[model samples]
Target: MRPAPLNPLTRAASLRALARTSPATPLDVLVVGGGVTGAGIALDAASRGLSVGIVEAADWATGTSSRSSKLIHGGLRYLEMLDFPLVAEALKERDLLLTRIAPHLVKPVSFILPFENPLADRVYVGSGVTLYDVMSARVGQKRAVPTHRQLGAAQSQERFPGLAAPYGGIEYYDAQVDDARFTQALVRSAVGLGASAANYARVVDYLREDAPAADEAGAAGGGSDGARVTGARIRDEETGAEVSVHAHATILATGVWTGEQQAAADADTGLEVLASKGIHVTVPRDRIDAPARVGVITRTETSVLFIIPWGELWLIGTTDTPWREDVGLPLVTATDIDRVLEGANAVLERPLTREDVVGSFAGLRPLLQPVDGTGDSARVSREHAVLEVAPGLSAIAGGKFTTYRVMAADAVDFAVRSRFPRSRSRTEDLPLLGADGAQLSASRRSLVLANRDLRAHGWDEARLDRLLSRYGGRLADLFALIDAEPALACPLPGAEHCTAAEVVYAVRAEGALHLEDVLHRRLRLEFEVPDRGVAAAEVAARLVAPVLGWDEDRVAEEVARFTSVVDARLRAEAAETDAGAVEAVAAARPGGGQGRRVRRIARM
Candidate 1:
């Protein structure tokens, strides 16, 4: 089938169509949430020639999806717990992402696991990593990444001179990606395959009863059972307009928000999903004085710590704390940052402080609570579950980021079986939007070098190769637009690696609706920029103004909104407690109604 266009124009039209349907046509599948899993489901079901529509209350990846460690791996630590199946499944998917699915977005990275005792530690960790590599090979997955190797103390020190101890370490491989971009690309790819997807469209309640029927007396009363879900009553956050869209099947992929959606769709389903918070801090590459590496998993008392490399910075994180606080604004508290710094600094010669942290983000993991109430969020299996809560409503949750595709496939399979029994999923071999061979090679160095404008901008073979590797073949399409408008090739005001044209492209082609979306996810300026892209907000907003049809007032508003978010992040970082931090971040978000609701809902 010919790929559908996923540019901004199409997205606007889709949203309009969704808003116009009075009684809403019943769809084959209606996916709530536009994050990675939902996008994946849309792609899976649509590729099978099923009609699919996905609705997100906010922008794509505006939640836990955008905030991740950004690593695509086999969960090396899981091996220690003897969770072989999860590790093996994740490894297979990791390979698929790196080689076949999103080679442009996902690339191999290396990490060093330092040890104080050379002999025992090396033997234990090395065995696990070696087994990890063997499993990847055993799965018939192409080993795009190299195998793990034992490193002597001297060699380890040479690679990471800042190591406190020189006993030795083991180097293992994994992959890194732009998580939000990957999610967007997944949505785009699904759209290209005829899936209907929209953002900022919130599902307030399930349409349980049929519309008033025209019987013998043409009476205005429901015809079907009142309890059975018929569709969803959706609200466009931007316009505050309500509309209903019927569907033959509904799949809830809202991650941490799954339980709430399920209960709204049906009260007696009684699904329990716990939100486990994980925080990541980004420091300048120069701060750590470590080689570009990945998989630096340090064993902790409760969980593992990872000091992974992300683009121009090192992403050190993640505290697996059970947070019962606000889920929507999962702000990284000072305490959380302190914990991460303490864990990561254990082996570092120079410890990282709040001053060294350029950017920090926290994501909530949707863990399924066990019935026995014996397991903690960390121990809850990353294995996903698909539960048919009602006749038309189904909820899927509790999967790791690496295995989103598997989770999506399973969820869609349940939807098909319970709601649309005739449909079959065909996404196993379906390539995403930019997966065509021609598009895959479009951003190659040779092709980029052929462009005179790129050459003029000092894009040598090496630089073009870097761009191609980062953008895959999609870089060609971006460059073509820049060729037509030379001014777009100029680098961002504050960020050197990113160009103004990229910002415009993000708004025009990538569905970037706000400055935060452009800086934080679209180009990663927030992570790469020292000020977290605070200084570049105005410039980025101006670049996207035309595409977004923003007037001067709207442009100023966007800029102000971006600044407020950055300010909130900074304030949250400075807060001493998690509650204060959550309040700070919540106060700065746009649309007071949604932000307050999110904060309240998250706390619940």
Candidate 2:
């Protein structure tokens, strides 16, 4: 059978297409949230040959999905918590990503867990890593990641130049990915399979057979009156336009915003999603004495700290604290910054100070509170829960980035349990858009890549290799755009390691509506620059302005809008408390009409 054409997700085209469906011709599934989980659900449902549409209230992956540590791993710390099943599940997904799913996007990364007491700590950590390897091995006959190995003091320091621990470290394997890009790829792939997706489309209320939802009236169980959710009342943030999307079933993958949606819907999902804020700071790669191959992971008093190597920077972070303020508008406050730096400084020969910090971000984990709701955010379970929020509506919250596919499969399974009897998850061996071609044997891939004409673009073999790793089979898609507009191949003046082609691609293909979306999420200039992408914003904005259909005034408006957020975020980072930070960011965030995609399966 001929599959549907992969039409570009230009903002105008998507909005028009998404607004077409009505109650008479409803979709099979309507997914809320364009993060990793919802994206995975879109693909899962489409692969089952069900008609699906996914909507996001903001930009795709602009929430927790984009702000993660970018690790694809079996939580090593979760092992100490004795969550064997969770560790095992995440390990299985990690391998699937490395070997079968997104090898180009998700690659093997080794971490050095430094030990102060060589004897006791080594034995204890070694056993834990050994178990981690065993769990991984059980999932796959061919090992996708390397096993744990003991490193001597000399070897440890050789791998990571700065070693605060006198004793050696345990070298173990995990994986890392560009989480936002990966989530976008899932949406693109799903769209290729005929699923409908739109961003900047927020669900204002739920659609019921009895009556349309009236601003919650009773967000947990009122107005619903045992009625089934027929669909959702969606608001177009850009135009202040509203539309009703009719679907047989609705799945809410709203992450931390799950609570807000539940309250608004008057549906008791039983699953209580508590927002736990985590912060990460970035420093230039040279700022930390760590090598490219070896990242550092150490035990913090409250949580684990990782000094992971990102392109030209070291991403170190993650303070786990309970948050009571906003849902998606998390800020990296002064205290949060200090907590992460102090944690990383404890295991560094030369400590990092506030001056060395370049960029930082914060994410809210939709931590599932225990039935008793007794433990702190750090101790809460990472396992996900699928709840029957109401008849024809399902909600899911809590899960590791590594195990998003599992959560998606479970959510789809629950949502369609009685509705679609023959439909089953077919995403186990499914490769994302770029993975199939990317999985070519290295030697063959190298030989094939060698034939590309890159002289005009000033790209060498190494640069092309990076392109292959980042785009996989989608290299052709990017090149197609460049071919149409030769100037796009030029390097972006301010943004290092990125080309103007990316900005155009983000709009034409990746559904990026504004300059902020390109600079922050698509190009990642925000996390890579000391000025927080402010300097690069103009060039990127100009490049994407035409594609996004912006005039001089619109371009300037976009740049100013982006700058306001960056300026606000910078101010927020200096604030002492979350409240202060919230006040700072909220002041700049414009909402009269503001931000935010999904999709299908080829292999299934």
Candidate 3:
């Protein structure tokens, strides 16, 4: 069946809905967090005919969701830890995403793991990758991804010229995705399924009804200590409006902020989430001199580094180090960049330098603090745990991107059990917003459609292909924008890959309230471009201003804010020490760019 188009999320309507929540018509489930898992939970609950609402403090994917390694594969390293179940479950989810859930967003990519010890290492790594392929095939879904194969050193170098020569390697298949876009699509899909979702809406505190009088206390669930959580007090970040939303059950999927969310509910649960920082360095693909189609994966002393191929860049990452700083602002320091470069240089034929890096981003992984004294966050299990913090409040934390759907299902299963024990999760078979129209023959159909409608307005095969890949069946919306104004068909100056229509569409269709949402999440210009979308910020703000109802001054302010964020990131990345990077990044905080005086005044 063809899914219905999603409703547009605007500031006015979302705020109005928040103001109207009452005990009479309370939401069946109120989900906190707008990441992949929370969006999945909203979709899961809404598909089963439940009233669901999800709220995010910042723009969608502003946290770890946007700053991932972007792979949708089973962790091969987990297999060495004798964790077969985790690998098997992840493979099944990967298969579902590749074939059914989000085929347009998730595409398969080949990866080669180089080995120095020809005989023993090849036997070990080859056997591991074989098992990985076998587990994926066992999922019973369509094996759209191919199996593993052996590659000689010459073959590996021929496939990937940038790699340092090794004895041999094992080539295997896995899937990659635009993680931020997928998360937004999930939220949109949930909204389409009758779920209410809002970004830039922060939940400050839970609303627990006061204890009844002494006479009525006995009648009301035995005593005053038996009070249950009723709802939450949400603060709208844009307008600073506070509203109370009543819900039957509240689910917290805040990744790194799991502890904070629970504390807001006054729950004294021992759900410790240690924040482990991982940084990724983006370099222009040409500088790496590697194949555009293949990715390189190798083991570093700390963790594995993946050189994944993005559209115009190579994303080389990730150092797993313990982080004790503020989780809200994770800065990519010189040390972080140097660590990544060191890892990449170990495998590349040509060593990468600091100048080779075009962009860098850091994300925090919410690793579950172990009780048995496992110090390494990498060794910690990616399995998530759900805790019933109170009578009706549930919080889940510590899971990988591949198993988000499962985590959502489990969290929702726990949250809704008391109310609707019979309700089962239907998200496994439920496709995302644009999935139904994205068939195997979608490319041929889109080309024909684009030629018919968009040929007159500067759209060719290449432009239509890019739009079709991102929007799937929803390409009609972009076409409509172009039809109204042919100038909207023109692409951005610095980032020609994105059009003005996309920026407008982001504010009007997607829930983009700020310039960062458009540049960082919607268009991906922040990470792809060297200036981090500063060159295109003015154009984007101007294009989206009319749609977003921004005045001349407001447009200028937005552009300035975005530029400051870019400058702050660059300064932080250039800092020599972690402490120095943290200090530099503080300047980009809410009122920081304006100065310490503004921050003090704002706090007052």
Candidate 4:
């Protein structure tokens, strides 16, 4: 069942695979960045039979990939801009992910756009929603979801119940996803397809050498005859171990860190990426009385506001502002939070407050620098651009999460021109790790499985549903953990819905190397809980210590560090100004230092 479960992403496997790859026998492709685009590139190249390896400075989706509105739709705003090609391309990719690529992870979601001016707003917004549905349907064999429909004030009030707008609204369908997990799934799928991937392996420097005998005589080696990028020197963030990897081609999908990475390689990146910071806050679902399960979209002074629904919580507010501060910790200040609350409260029947917030996060979008440098961050083009930053090295930037696969394919197609000319794009029809054959809906098979599991262990329906959402059809993997250790089946402390087995599985199967990685990225308890996972930090650390080779002191250190990080975030969120928030967050940096230190050396 479930295709025997795809290959697990263990820590040992990552280190060993990196050890096995070297410059003498260079990999066909080396991807720098473990975000969605880089992971997708690795899968695309490896699926096409290329020997590929991907490395990240931190965990997968530790950057902007995880900090999105979590929508998989042709940006309706782009339609207003008259950018049809980008919209069409995104719609096609969205359909692909929903139908074939990751059916288990991507699902349709409905959204309502409240209108103050019934007639004028309906005509304006209705046309856009209709066009969005039309564009999405035209890209695939079947309509991905129900088309747009108009609703009267009574109906809108019935659906939302907490409507501040006097006029009725129009509802349309898009899609929502767990952005972090979706990114992790991409990496896991790539690894399953023979791609070597390692998180926390920071690529510090470039490895260059004279052209090989197979190359055109004077094609390489400095100046016009550029030196080829043989590989890169990488450092293990955990143990500080260093190694060099040889790759025929190196692809940089470093997102907002594109400049720093290209600068380390000592080459002109050709394109500049402006870091546009976006912030999101989470509140309990009960705070909003919308029983229709429909997301809310409203216009803000800057851009649009999306109030997406999470399991028991509602994900709200995303402010688009230019950020030039420390990229390591993008903290949300009081002003940012207030801006979000004000925007949402202006339209919601009941307003959310600071006391209602459970968690918040901020991330930078690697928007392409405007030629005139005059437009707002929201007006910046999201189209990806690829360029040869150096011989045998290519970098791609400025694409959205929904279009990562297409961006990856395009980047690989550019990288392999002179090197692996035989390699071709093959990920168009490829499904991710959990998306194999026929996938039973969560309600369909999970209900039966939950009934059996409940009879056997008296597990709650919430726990089973959480497992299905995280693991999809691979719920058997958790079952295997429970079989091995009955005690692990118990719910994790402070995070009752999560099991101790899941924490252990995060390390042994999901390559969770650090306590923070497990809590923040894998288990996601860090933000989901009001304490920011503090109550579960020690429990999680102790549970995962053996698998990660952490002793008592290390466990204590991890727990303390995670607690401090949470404290810092809370303090930053309380700050009145950006400067004060940045200062407070900087003090909370693990070890009072920068996020990850990447050292580039020529003679390493």
Candidate 5:
């Protein structure tokens, strides 16, 4: 049978049903965390015909999942550490995402790993890169990307004129994706497969019995070993309503938040997820005036830094520092920005300064601290671990974003084998929502045309490509709305690449609740453009006002809140010197607005 369509009406009805009807029987699985891993698990379990539901404390990918380096690579640096399995696993998934699963959303991008110390270092790093390419090809994965090649200093300089001279390099291939959109698409696929999911619903506590009740009658089944975690008590963060959801199995994919959830279970899961903050600074394409062809990978003492090309902007980042404060909101500090700029400038002919930074973001990588506690969190394993905290609660942590599918599969495998005992993993060969061949091709052409033709309206090809790449075949769904309402096609006043129609589509179709969702994830105006989408907030709010039933007052309030968020982010970025300082600034920001907004349309 054909799967049901996942549209606005379908999602609304599912939320209503889940809220209204208390399931008489416990669900097969309940996933906590609406990030990539949780969404992947939801899709995996639901596709297998299992009863599944996922609850998130915030909007999808509002956490680390959305704030990432956004690379879908095999972790080339891991090869140097002789972690073959990690590299192999990530490479397989990278191929899957780029070719079979989310072709429209994930595409190949090349990176130039510069070698400052020539001679021995050149041959040594070149050999490692060769292995990386060889292994990728050995898997019989479609060569969606070209192979790597060695470049002399002059040739490398020609490719990336920004590089300071005497830089021999190895050019290799990787993939880039819009992390938030990919996670959202995964949730949508799971919903299409009958999985119930809700963002802003936080699992506050686990329901456990103090003692097992002795059934004198001795029931046919287990006789309620205190019902073995009958369910979880969840608080709807948006509405402040508390409810219980019963499930035979619960999977915790909360990433950095895994520790708190584990503590709530009161079980010695022996798992600890440490937060490692990585900051990325975005600058305009013209700022560097260098060859914008491939990404640049520079070696650092602890981790490698990447100068990635993200559409019209270049994303230079990432400092691997321990985060000691709030894990939920990791902010990019001025110091973090300075560190990245300093690192990139070490290779660039013309060094970058604070003035070149248009925007900055920070995300926490959930690292699995070993029980031995011998090594720092940065050196901790990137491999994922699944532990049964309690009879019904399972927690997974310590993995890279590129391997979310594998982590999801492992979590689902554990849940299925524990609960059903007869089921086997099926997601290894499964495809996401837009992966079908015909739909994928049509989506690509439509995206190209939409971007090319829309130039008359101020959208350049690069902007259109970025949108198409992020949405994949789903671009048509957005354009359909624009076709119905011609005014929706107008570009957001300040955010020229975005249109009023996108905000409406984000709310009506993409499950966007707040202005932040529209600005940050749905449109990416927050990161791609300067002022962090502040100037375009009012126009976006107005565009979605009818759909959300917002009166003039509500629209103005929404706009004000968005502007405050941007202002706070700017202030925080300026005030802090490191990730920790950046987080402090974020802590002081008001409105407690971490995720999506509630949709409230005024009665016409």
Candidate 6:
């Protein structure tokens, strides 16, 4: 059976559903993080016919999940590391997502692994890419992308003009997504399947049957009475209110906060995860002079660099290094920017400068640390570990964005398999909210013809195509919003690619609690633009204020708060050192506009 359409992720609906789970009458499963894994878990549990609730500390995908390299390919570098299982597993899931799960959110993208030394480099790299394809072919009923093809030096240069050396290249296929939006889609899909979810809801402490007080180390959830973990004492971060959400089983997919959760749960058993900071910088599409959709993948001394082609800009990234600083403040420094620029310049025909960079971001990967602590994050295992931290509590850590579904299932199997042994995960076959509509509309002409009303409002085929690509089947919802108010059919004030209806849909349908969530995650005006979306922040706030019931002062505060955050990121990006960058963004650490909680919510 096809999954139902999404439910509006309003705070009112989420809280009312959460209020149903009490100590006496607990829900089936409580997923304690709302990142990709947690959201995936909620959907996985719900699809398998279980009552589930997923809560996040901040907005969904505000962690590592949102800040990925935005690639959905098997780890080609892992093949070099001789870890075939990880690559194979990821390839299977990758195809599943591309074909069945999230066809709308994830799309096929091509990359050129350019060769400087055609002799040995071609053989070594070509062999690995061949293996990557074979693994994918063996995974599922249908292949998601085409196999790799080798090109000559001139041929490669003709295909990808940005190649520094025209010694030929291996053209391979992968998929890319708007990471934050993909995470949000996963959430809405889960909600459609009856998973109660809310952002800005933090779990303060675990709710257990019998537990002891803190020790010298301030340990929580410890007891001598054979205590079984029940649920959590959650604090609404938007409001100061607290709630007791009871559950039969609890799963923790908190990513980098795994260690802290271990101590919080007072569990002697679990995974030891380390934080690895990976940063990326984005420049205008014309900077490197690359082809329409073809990107370059070059090997760095430490890790591989991906020059991913996002909508209007080129995303160059990823430096993997040990990070021991605050996880929430994952800001990029001058050194990080310099490293990324240098890595890209090594492959690009034209070098990218600091001024060319429009925006940058950093995400902390939760890697399963080796016992000796090799200090090299690249050497650490990306494979996740799931174990019972307590009787009713289970935690999952490590793994990459590509394999979140497998991780979620593993975590669920550990937490609930023993209790409900017959229950199996059904998410692999479930299409996310927007996927059905995207598949139904084959091309731009079909979509434009279907929504002739958009043409009446001066919306062209390009605008309609963009909407379908972003919202998929959910595009109808936007059309409905535009029909309600013709003004909503217009584009956002500063961010021209986004429509005014998106802001309202973000508030009403998506769970965008603050200005930051809508701009940064929903519209992606934050990292995609040069001004870091500060230009559109005010207009966006104004558009969403009425739906959220914000007064003039509140709208001003939202705009001001988002502007301050943008300024802080700029200061951080300009700072000389990583430590200096951290200090620069000290003021922007997640919780500024919490004085007055949202009182009213727009009905679905």
* lDDT for each residue of candidate 5 in 1-604, tens digit (9 for 90 to 100): 1333443455455555555434467788889988889999998888789988888776788888788898899988789789998898888889888778888778788888878778887889888988998878744345767999888999988888877748578888999988888888888888877888777677888876443454311122211234345468888665687777777778889888887887787755446888888989999887665555578888766668988887778998889998886675566677788888888888888878898888888888888876432211112235877765555566778788899888887787765563566776677677776665323345665565666466566665555655666665666666787678766667778887777777787887777767887888778776788788988888888877877778999898888877766776676687655554545554545644432221100000
Q: What is the lDDT of residue 548 in candidate 2?
A: 63
Q: What tens digits encode model 4's per-residue C-alpha lDDT throughout 8-66?
A: 33554666776677767788899999888898898899888888889988777887777
Superposed on all Cα atoms, the candidates' RMSDs to the truth, in angstroms, are 5.3, 5.5, 4.6, 4.5, 5.2, 5.3
lDDT score for candidate 4 against the true structure: 0.77
Candidate 3 global lDDT = 0.78
Between candidates 5 and 6, the one scoring higher on TM-score is 6
Provide the lDDT at 310 for model 4.
83
Candidate 2 minimal-lDDT segment of 10 residues: 595-604
Candidate 3: the clashing residue pairs are none
lDDT of 6 by residue, 1-604 (tens): 3333332335657767887788888989999887888988998898888889998877888888778898887888888789988888888888988988888888889999888787988898888888889888953366788999998988887887877766898999988888888888888888777778878788888887754343211232222234678898888876768888899888888888887787898876666888888999999887767676788898898878999988779998899998877766677899999999999888888888989988888888887854232111122235876666665677778787888888878777666765687888887888888887674444756666565566655566667667777899888787788778889987787888778999888887888878988988888776788887898988889988887889999899888777777787788888877788867766444563331221111000
The CA-based lDDT of model 5 is what? 0.74
Q: How many pairs in model 3 have backbone atoms within 3 A of each other, for residues 3 or more apart or on separate chains, i.e. clashes?
A: 0
lDDT of each: 0.73, 0.78, 0.78, 0.77, 0.74, 0.78
Q: What's the CA error at residue 100 for candidate 2, in Å?
A: 1.1
- Kindly report the root-mean-square deviation of model 4 from the true structure over all alpha carbons: 4.5
Per-prediction backbone clash count:
7, 12, 0, 1, 7, 2
The window of 10 residues in a row where model 6 has the poorest summed lDDT is 595-604
My TM-score estimates for the predictions, one after another, are 0.89, 0.90, 0.91, 0.91, 0.89, 0.91
